[model samples]
Target: MTNDMKLNKLLLTLSVGALSFIQACRSPESDEKLKSTIQAALETTPGIEVNVEEGNVTLDGQIGSDSLKQNIEDKTKMAGGENIKSIHNNIVVNLPEPEDAREKYHEIIGGAVDSTLTRDVNLVLADFPTITAQVKEGIIVATGNLEKSKIDTLKKRLEHIKPKGIDMKGVISR
Candidate 1:
C-alpha cells in the first residue's frame, strides 16, 4: 500500500479505538444498576438501605460509630463508581446508654471479644507495639513486654477507658 494510504488507515483505526474506550469508561445508563452495585459493596453490613435517583445516592442505616458510618459512605461511592454524583449519608450512630462501669475484677477470656471493643483496645495500644489487649465481658487482659514505668502508665490509661479490670499478669517488666 502507498504511504498515504497506510497513514489514513492508521488514523481511522485510532479513531475507532478511542471511541470504544470512551464508551467503556461511561457510567451505568440506569440508576437501578448503580444502586445494585452499591448494594453489593455494602452487603456485609446490616441495617443499611440504599436508594438512587438520577445519580444521587441516599444511604440510610444505624451503625455503632461515626467512623463506621463514614466508611459505609466511602464504600458506596467506590461501588457506584462514576455513576454516583452525590451521597447523602443519613446513617444514625446509635450510641448506647452510659454504663455504670463498676468493673471490680478481671475475667479470663476464652476467645475473642466484640469486634468494636477489640478495635478500640488496639487503637489505645497503637503507641505500645509490644502490648496487645483483649476484652471479655468488660474485662481487659493485656499481655506484652515493656519498661516498668511504661507499664504503670499503660495501666492508668487503660483504667481511663474503664474496662472492668486490667490484667497485666502476662506482661513482662524490664
Candidate 2:
C-alpha cells in the first residue's frame, strides 16, 4: 500500500475505536442527572422513588392508580432520555378499596328510613328528597341537598341512632 493509503486506514480504525469507546462509556454524572431529572418530574407525586446506575433505572415504591403509574413511567422514560438502556419498574399499585358505605351503615340509618316509611310513604318522600345515608365503620355519611329546616329535623332523628359521627359535609342547604 502507498503511504497515504496506510495513513487513511489507520485514521479510519482509530475513529471506529473512539466511537466504540464513547458508546461504551457511561458517566456517573449522567446517571445522577437522569435520577435528578426523574425526581424533579415526579417530586409532586407521592410514593415514587428512582435509582439510576450506568444507564439503567430502577423504579420502586407505590402509585395510587394504574393511570397514574403509567403516567409516571411515561414521564420517567421521557426524562431518562436516550441514555437509558433499561428500566426495571418495581412500582406497586397501592389503592384503598372503596368502602361499601350503604351495607356498613345500613343498620345505623335503616331504622330512620323504616320509621319514616311506617309513618307515611309521602312523608318520607316529601321530607327527604334524594337523601342517601351510609354508615362505614361507625361513621355516618349523609348526602343530599337538604333545606335547613329538614337538616335540623334529620339531625334530631339521627341523634337517637347513635353513630360514631355523622358527616353531613356533602349535604348542601338550599
Candidate 3:
C-alpha cells in the first residue's frame, strides 16, 4: 500500500478501537434519564421530590396514607425499571390524629399488621442467610454481611413492606 493509504487505514482502526472502549465503559443507565423516568411516574402525585444518582433513587414528600406512599414508591420503581440500584422512600404519611392518639397507637401495637410485618421480616431474613433483621413499631433494623450484588435486591424486598424506615447501618457489604 502507498504511505497515504497505510496512514488512513491506521486512523480508521484507531477510531474503531476508541469507540469500542467507550461503549464498554459506559454504564447501562444514565442518572438523568433514570430521574426523568421516575419523575414521570410521580408526576400525578404532588409534593413529591425525586432524586436519582448512579441509579439510586430517593423519594421525599408528604402523602395521606401508608398505602399511598407505598403505591408511589412502587410506581417509581416500576418506571425506573431494571436500571435502579437502590431506593429510599422518605415520604411521610400524614394521618389525621385519632380521637385519642395514644389509645389509637396502643390499639395498633401488636395488631395484625405488626404480626404480618414480623412474619414477613423473618421470611426475608431467611432468604438472606448472611443477614439478620428485626422489625418493631414499623421499622426494620438489619445487620450482617451481605454480598455487594445482593444489596439492591435486599433493599427492594425490605422496602416492599413500607416500613417507617430501614436502618442498615450495621450491615457490612463485600
Candidate 4:
C-alpha cells in the first residue's frame, strides 16, 4: 500500500481506539462520585448502611421510622446524580414477630400478619413483605397497618423481643 494510505489508516485506528478508551474511563469517576454521595447520605441518617456495587447503591439497615427511610432516599438521589442505576431501599425498621429468633425476621413478621390483629390494622403484608428488619446482616420482614401514634408504641413493644432482625412494613393510617 502507498505510505499516505497506510498513514491515514493508522490515524483512523488510533482515533477509534482513543475514543473507546475515553468512554471506558468515564464511568469510574462517575461511580466514585456516586459512592461519595451515597456515603454522605447514609452518614446523615442514623442506622442507615449503604453499599455500592457496579454503580447501584443498596441501602441496608434500620431507620427509626419509614419517613426517615424516604428522606434518606431523597437526599441520596439529590447528591448521587441522576446516573445512579438503582437505589435499593432495603432498610427495615425494628418490630415484633412470633417464631424462633434465629430464623428470618420476615417469617416472624409473616406470622404476625397472619394473626388476628393484622386485619384490625387494615394492612396487608405482601408475599415478600417490603419491610425488612436487619441488623448486622440478620433480617426479618414486618408488614401491616400502622397509625402514627401506634408506630412508636409498636416499636417499643418489639424492642423487648430483640430478634436478630425486624422488618416493619406498617402502612400509615389512611
TM-score of each: 0.46, 0.50, 0.40, 0.39
lDDT of 3: 0.74
Q: Supply every candidate's count of residue pairs whose N, Cα or C atoms clash at under 3 angstroms.
A: 0, 1, 0, 8
lDDT digits (tens) for residues 101-158 of candidate 2 = 2232243234333323222223333558767776555556778888887887876565
Worst 10 residues of 2 by lDDT: 96-105
- Model 1, 13-42: lDDT tens per residue? 999999988754545567788888999998
| Regions more than 4 Å wrong, model 4 | 1-29, 95-174
| Per-candidate local distance difference test | 0.73, 0.67, 0.74, 0.56
> Candidate 4 residues 1-174, lDDT tens each?
999999999999999999987754546667777787778756645566776665687888874434445767887888777667678989896542433322333332333322223331223223223332333333334555555666666565454444444566543542
Error of 4 at 128 (Å): 34
lDDT of 3 by residue, 1-174 (tens): 999999999999999999988654535458788888888877777779988776778999976557567778888879988878789999997753323332333333333344446666787788899998877776789999999899888988888756667889978999
Error of 4 at 7 (Å): 18
Task: Give the per-residue Cα lDDT of candidate 3 at 96.
Answer: 35
- Model 3 scores a TM of 0.40
Clashing pairs in 4: 105-140, 105-141, 106-140, 106-141, 133-166, 133-167, 142-167, 142-169
By TM-score: ranked, best first: 2, 1, 3, 4
Top of the candidates by TM-score: 2
Candidate 1 clashes between residue pairs 3 or more apart in a chain or in different chains: none
Q: Candidate 4: how large is its RMSD?
A: 12.9
Model 2 clashes, total count? 1
Highest lDDT, which number?
3
